[model samples]
Target: MDSRLDDARGAGRRRIPVALDGLEQWLRIPSISGDPAHRGDVARAAEWIAARLAKTTGAVRIVRSAHNPVVLARVSATRPAVARLLVYGHLDVKPPGPGWTSKPFEPVRRGGLLIARGASDDKGQFMAHVAAVEAWASIGGPPLDVSFVVDGAEEIGSPGLKAVLDRHRGLLGADAATVLISDTKMAGPGRPTLTVSQRGMLGVKVVVSTGREGVHAGRYGGAVIDPTQVLAAAILRAARVVRRLTGAGRPPGPTDADVRNGAAGRAVHRDRLAERSTTCGALTVTSFESGSTAGAIPTTAKATLDVRIPPQLNVADAYRAIAAALRGNDHPRVDLQLNCMASASGVLLRQPPTVRQNVDRACRLAFGRPAASISSGGSIPAVDLLFRIFGRPPILLGFGPPDDGAHGPDERIHLGDWANCVETSICLMGFLSGSVTAASTQHPDSSFSDTLFPHGSRGTAALL
Candidate 1:
């Protein structure tokens, strides 16, 4: 093994303490972007990122948005950048709802796992990239022009991302450059996985009104239409509409490869993939309210519907179909209203050959094996928006394992897995250094085949 490779591995291992400490500090901030009470914490988290990136980046600034701030950093190479790579991730996290072995904000390491609110959801995963860059600096500087776009409002649907992305599109990448993201989950512990697709989401509420006030059931039992019954009818109609629009066939069954490569592949047999894929469009009535008593004909009733649209269907079209369905049976007896709360489109990533080859190499160095391609049932609104603006597909590489309990209590990521993530990121820098043209004039779809194996094209290990 090359001495520098040994040095790099040693350098990476030495930074583990710092990575853990950094993640703990970040988790302590309680930067819950969804809660107004934690607004300041969110801002503080952005400042923390700026402060860390300031050491290596020439320009580090927090871009203000309507909701939360965005941290943007730029690192210029000694020689003109052969290519630019945008590292995308979020610092914000979901609120610690309930259930915990310890305080969600207090980071803890049990066995080989680091536990906390944002431990695995994103903070730990994204910071792995930050630490990777730090490790590179310890051994030597990076080989490409790299920029970081760590935002603060990912948990709340990234409502402010579209404007931020559009405003800074040029700064992000003028033509098109590869974007790296680490907010998804790996197949399983010690196994690196790349997510290639995410499902879209649409939330709606159905309100039915029959009269100004509830009527006595005995006096108007058959005289008046029950609002609860009307709401039920509306929900039934919505289901029919979805069926018509999305069709009766099960979502294209997950390919045999999908089942084999998934993180739970060992536990999830091929026959189970279809059952799992059915969850892609699972629709649920999250909430329903009508009358206080069974003896009264309710005056009004409301139902909130949660809909998950598969990648094959258009999110907007599905939402429209839902609206049309609600309006289909407008009658004089009852008034119905369909309120669309939110909708985010799904994404399908196309891994260019250059990215796939280097990422495979990086996985081998990071996990002692090649990576498995997987798909996510969740949605990240910013990803689809970023693709629309940059025209380059973002590489979705994450360190969180399937059992990390993201968005739930005792959220955690394996310390060993995180270490692998750090090593993988470091290897990617070398692999992608000469992979892109230094000049930005190259065509958006173009990628050079030359790989800059700084030390050599070999994977090395110092310590796990």
Candidate 2:
């Protein structure tokens, strides 16, 4: 073990509370990217983090994008380094819907968990890494050359991440970076997990509208058309398509014990992922709005659906299929429209055994156990883009507890798990420093991803 590792770990442990404080402060911003009303709040959150990071990082630049600004920073190596690394995470959060015991923006500590909208999802998880970085800074600097990109529009599908990457192409070259992401969830509470695969997603908004304004329900009960009823029919049609699309995907998943410790739900059958068959659509109706008056029929009713896309299925093909189903049997009185909110290809990350070994060693040291690589159902739209850019899939670390209620009410993070996460990240930095060789510990047949991802590591991009 390198002396620096112990020194860095000690430094990190001593400042663990600072990390918690950071999470608390940032959670108050209400940086909901999905809601246009919170646009400025999102940007404010980015600036707040960037300013704090500037103290230890070099050239913390805020790059403007079509949607939200990106915060970029570099941390120079204090000594000789073996790898050039990039960290990615998001700062934006999903809208805080109903059902909260406390205020969403106000951070509340309940028992061992920290309650806030982005707590377990990314904010709490990524702050661990931020704390680790600050620790290294306290002891001079990190052993590996590192840079981070904090995305401000990830919740809304990172509409401008590609352009931001393209603009900073040389700084974040595909040949240079090994990515790391902390936006995923643990297999279960207190179980350290590494996500090796992610599903693709296509989000569409369904709107049923009448040309005229709302009318009295009694007057239009039989004469006029109700968009709400039409919207319901459309949703019903979508549900049927989902049933047929996923009919061939009832295959059982692997049992948990070895590789899938505490993993929930059956896994997606490869056949389903490869062909048009889908394991599940996750056709979540995120938002629904219609009439407000009790006695009136609204002019329009709209709702959004988030459908999962198999890695094998292209976004356009899935889009066309769903669009056709929604319009195949149109309602004459009401017009329907589709707003494509998100579209991204899913990718199966094949990280080298060496990379897994490095992270596993850290997990064991920090969490009392090694990690298992699992496929995740949730979609992080930027993962595929980063894979293409880096030529290798980044190592996705899950620090949040399972059932953290992300994107829903009462979102929270376990403080104990959070401490472990900070320690694990600190250990990873030490391992990646090229000072500690895990050659003996690496599993046999370990090889780099036919090509390691060329994209940058997931930074506060997932947290911000």
TM-score of each: 0.83, 0.82
TM-score of 2: 0.82
lDDT top scorer = 2
Query: Looking at model 2, how many pairs of residues clash?
Result: 32
State the weakest 10-residue window (summed lDDT) of model 2. Answer: 446-455
Per-residue lDDT tens digits for candidate 2, residues 146-257, read 7788899888889989888888865543356788889987876667788766667888899888867778889778778888888887877776665444323332222334
Q: With candidate 1 superimposed using the best TM-score fit, by how many Å does residue 277's alpha carbon deviate from the native?
A: 3.6
- Model 2 misplacement above 4 A: 1-3, 172-174, 213-226, 246-278, 291-299, 330-334, 437-464
Candidate 1 lDDT, 48-165, residue by residue in tens: 8889988876578889978898888876544566667788899999989877778999887665567889988888999988887787677565666778888898876777777776
On TM-score, the leading prediction is: 1
lDDT, model 1, position 407: 85
